[model samples]
Target: MKRFINKWWRGRIAKLDLCPLPKALAPLENGRVLIFAPHQDDETIGCGGTLALLRKNGCEVKAVFVTDGGGAGGLPEGTVAIRKKEAAAALAVLGVDDLVFLDEPDGSFRNTLGFEQKIMAILDQFQPDWLFMPSVLDYHRDHVAIGQALYACWRRWQGTARAFFYEIWSPLPATWVVDISSVAELKRSALSRYELPLAHCDYLSASMGLAAYRGLYLSCNGQSGLAEAFVEAENNGIWSGISERMLALRIYFEKLLKR
Candidate 1:
């Protein structure tokens, strides 16, 4: 039954018209991009292809790890150290050398003013031309917190950078897509570096599946390869719904039910 549903879902997605996504997000010469991940793997799982492409185009990319992934259960001791090493290796694959670790408590990201200020400080310091983060609707509590925190800062930061939201635990209603076919293999290889997490879950396959699902939204070559999806900050209503505080309350309860 599950297999049938999966196939049906794929077919239904494939038959839909191309989603209204812009062209691939390539970085300008010497451009800068900053990405925030609730955990180490989310960055690679979400936009590894885009990062690789940006680096190849002489873009300076920095990834900020919001948590150490130590909060996840069923993991061996020293998992945090292991994941950091894995992340470094993976980023190295894309020629990315700038990495930041916030060391925030995993599964406990509160959308507080202090937290927002910390993130805002980073944004003001980096002033990256492109900012990427987990989607607020992401099922993971940390993902939602970081997304909402960044969203809050974005409301005040006058920087010219464009913000985008990515997905991992849950698929987002994407308003933009990046053709990742060329870097698909690289993205897969990068994801495979996480031996610790891969031992627990086949994240490589899952990442590929999501990327392929996004590919189905493309018209070129009739979905030949992987693509990454994102929702532009201006277009996404993760905060501007009914009321920000009310929406937050609704999402909090919805998250509880989903759990």
Candidate 2:
């Protein structure tokens, strides 16, 4: 069985493009990390492996679910409660208990001044060394809006958190990748708690596939492991990064308007 699994993984690895290896994240000794998820399951989907590693290395980690997730899965009346419960269970499995559910409405996340203030408040309170958020290029409107709002808040507050963007509905051009091979099963266990999402889309398989692809990249770089990928940037570069993205968006929309 083990040999068969190895053969299959190697076969998958063989087809992947071997890009320059992503920088490996050093384990935190006593650091603080924060994650902003547009919805409940994104935190687990995008960075569960890193979260597990952080906990294992004694890093303080907290997650903020920006939306109540009530607008998804066609069960509005009970969706929020169900998803939140699931998220709590999932995070608990990762040894993460400090969760903050912002309870904002899903699908209509705003990038307003008030929203920025709310995000800034959390930044003020946590002041994490590392902050992770959904990538701005994510196809989901809520994900994109939350990412923009968080970046705006960081600009205002000039918070000290080093920014990293995680992928979900879109893949980031990752500058760093953390080998989560050791904690692969832990990530699976955490994600399995999202019963509703898993029922709709086999997120477990999709997410694992991405991780496996990243692992192949790592292997090509001489590391035999699975990985979670991210676009890492220092605080100084965040505003510029946001500006570049906004400019491109504006150009695209302007062209659409001309049409």
Candidate 3:
């Protein structure tokens, strides 16, 4: 029954119209992009293709792993080190050279002053124009904690950065979608770097299908694929719900202006 369902879904996804890439929304040349991942593999799963696109378009991208992801069951000890290596490999595949690992305890992440301080310090130093983090509605405890902490920090920053939430274990009602059809293979290759996750294939395949489904919904080519759906929140003067394609286009144009 599940196989039948999967087949049906895949067929439906293949029939949808392709969404064309839109103009860049904000300038990203002088701007920095910060992606906050709750675990090592998430950076690849959520934004791998988008990161590649950003680099190709000349945007500086940075990623911060909120936890060491040592708690993924079924590993003999030293899983954290193993996963960190996997993350590094994955980031390299996505063309991300600037990566930071917070090494917070796997299952024990909290919305505490210490964590906030660490995040705030990074934000202050990087001064990113766009910030990406896990969605508030994710099923993982660590993801939610990071989202809450980031939200508080964003409020304190007062619209200095445009923030968007990406998905991990939960489905986000995305207000913006990035057409990632062009980099689907890059995303898959990046995800394959994670070897500790016994069920990594299932996770990766489901995410790919979801991205295809979203691409169809956005009228993008079904085979081209999409990545990185974001829910935007209105903070201070900056508003959410702007198209992700438009946002990328804006960043591209902004980079051109800087050059």
Candidate 4:
């Protein structure tokens, strides 16, 4: 039954001719892009390829790691410093020089007033054309929290910045996809920098595989390519509806992540 539904849904979307596969190529050059990660490695896992593509197209890119990444999410204690180092190396491969570390608690992100203020401060300062964050439907609590907080910040600020939500532990209902076949190797190298986290989870292979899957049906020829999925931030009515539905199941998801 699930398989049938999935096939029917794919078939329904396949008929569309949105830029030849729902591809978004706006502001492809000379744009400001800001990305926020719940952990040291989430940035790379979520949109490393898009980061590379953006830099290649001359976009000013800034990445912010929202957590210390220590003794949480299966990582060991005292690993925060090392993870930051790893992040520097990984982002370097993507040609990202501007980085920020918020040093908030790992696996424990609350949408507190202070937290929202910090996030909004960056929005005011950077004034990014594109803001990258994790998807609210992601499996991890940290991912969801960061996404929600970012959403809330945008709500209050109501700035011109556009939000692009990426997939990590959960697949997003993508509004568009960015072809990253040109920088697939760069993304692979970036993912390889985090040896410690790779040991815990094979994100390199998983991310690459997901990218391939995203590109498989959308590619021009029979050859398979790599792409990254992004769901643009919806308007207030739609976004509020989605958030309310997700929050209704917060208790269940929290228990699942904790266990």
Candidate 5:
């Protein structure tokens, strides 16, 4: 891994067109990291490996699930409770002890009526050094809603955490990536804890596959890596830009779905 990464120091860039090679993450010695997951399994699907890596590097990782996860049709009774339990077990695999559930209506979650307040409250309380959120471009309404509400909450946010938007229902045009080759299997195990999502969709395999592919940007001639992609929104201006793009995406998806 060091050999391949050293290529960056030797003026090596761009593995190929459309694959603007992402770099590895610098280890965090100590800091508080918070993640806002739109659903129970999304946290594992999107950044479980990164979370594991962060823990290994001594970062305190916390998670927040914004939905009850009852929107997916055909789920068994008590889906909300079942999924929450699953999330608890999963995050434990990644060494995260703190978890918060917002219990918003899954499919109908919007950016108003206390959504922003909830986010602001968490932001105020956590005072994280790093924060993770769903991509603004995600097709899931709940995922987009979180981004929208966070943008609104940013107006009063006093925390100086750098934001990273992770991929779930959408693939991010990532600005950075964290190599998680060592913790990939841990992530798989974490994701596998979601029995409900696993029964309906092969999210475990899909998420691992995406991580492996993202690692290619960091891969040289060897296959010793997996990675999580993210769009870094480091400030209020960047958050505003994300909001504008999210609005455009909402319109585009609305029309596309109608068609």
Candidate 6:
């Protein structure tokens, strides 16, 4: 039933009258991107293709793992250490050399000053042109906490950077989609580096299929392929292509329904 629902919604998304936003908002050139992942492997799952695309376009990308991912069960005492190693491997596969780990306790992430300070320090130092964090609507407590932290930080910083939210184990009300069609394989390879926990789950194929669906929606609307989606929280002078993409998606999904 879960699979059926997912498929049903996927097809509905295809027929959506999408209004894709312009590409100018996500300008890859002369931009610094900081991807904040709640766990070690999320960077690859959520934005690996974007990382690869940015790298290919000569953009600077840095990743920060917010937690050690020690509480997902199945660890044999030194699980955090193993997860860190696996994370390193995954980043290396994606060609992202700049990485940082907050080393915070997994499954207990909170929106406290201590946590905010650590993230603030990184943001101040990096001063990224763009920031990516988990969606606020995620089902996981840690994910939602991280999103709140980022939101608070962004507000404190007066929205200095372009902030976007990615999805993981949750459904994001997407306002923008980035075509990652060319780098989908690279994303798959990067995701494959996390052999510990993901090896036991069926995430890769489903994730890829989602990307494909997003791509098809973009293509039908006369845009690029393989895509990652996000919702724009604040648009202060940033010309995000959200409205355009949404229109395109709506039309695509409507057309699919006619078929």
| Candidate 3 backbone overlaps, count | 18
lDDT winner between candidates 2 and 3: 2
Please write out the lDDT profile of model 2 over residues 159-248, one tens digit for every residue: 677888899976777888889999999999999999988888998999998999888767655687789998875556765776467536
Candidate 3 lDDT by residue in tens digits, 1-259: 9999999999998998674342222224546789999998887777787777777778889999988888845657888889888988988888888989888888888777888888888888998888888876676667777777887787687448878788777677676778777778888888888877845447778778777766754453233445557776557444423333434544565578679
Tell me how many clashing residue pairs each candidate has. 0, 0, 18, 0, 0, 33
- Highest-scoring model, lDDT: 4
Q: Could you tell which candidate, 5 or 6, scores higher by lDDT?
A: 5
The residue ranges of model 4 lying beyond 4 angstroms of the native Cα positions read 1-21, 24-27, 73-77, 220-224, 246-259
* Root-mean-square deviation of every model: 7.4, 10.2, 12.6, 5.2, 8.0, 9.5
TM-score of 5: 0.86
Candidates' lDDT values, in order?
0.81, 0.84, 0.75, 0.84, 0.82, 0.77
Candidates sorted by lDDT, best first: 4, 2, 5, 1, 6, 3
Once fitted onto the true fold, the runs of candidate 1 whose alpha carbons sit more than 4 angstroms away are: 1-29, 72-74, 220-224, 235-239, 242-259
Q: Which candidate, 2 or 6, would have the higher lDDT against the true structure?
A: 2
**Candidate 4 lDDT, 7-118, residue by residue in tens:** 9999999998675445544336889999999998899998999999999999999999998888455655668988999999999999998999988998777778888888
Model 6, residue 141: C-alpha shift (Å): 1.3
Write out the backbone clash pairs for model 4: none
Tens-place lDDT per residue, model 6, 1-259, is 9999999999999998676543313547757889999998877877788888788877788999988889856568988888889888888877789989887778888777888888888888998888898876666668777877877677677437888888777556776778887788888988887877786787788778778766655764578567877776674423334434533554565578679
Candidate of highest TM-score:
5
> Across residues 1-259, which tens digit of lDDT does each residue of candidate 1 receive?
9999999999999999774544444445578999998898899999999899889888989899988778656667988898899999999987788999888877776676776777888888988998897887777778877887787687688788888888888887677778788888889888988887788799799889888888876764344567898877763475466226533764887868978
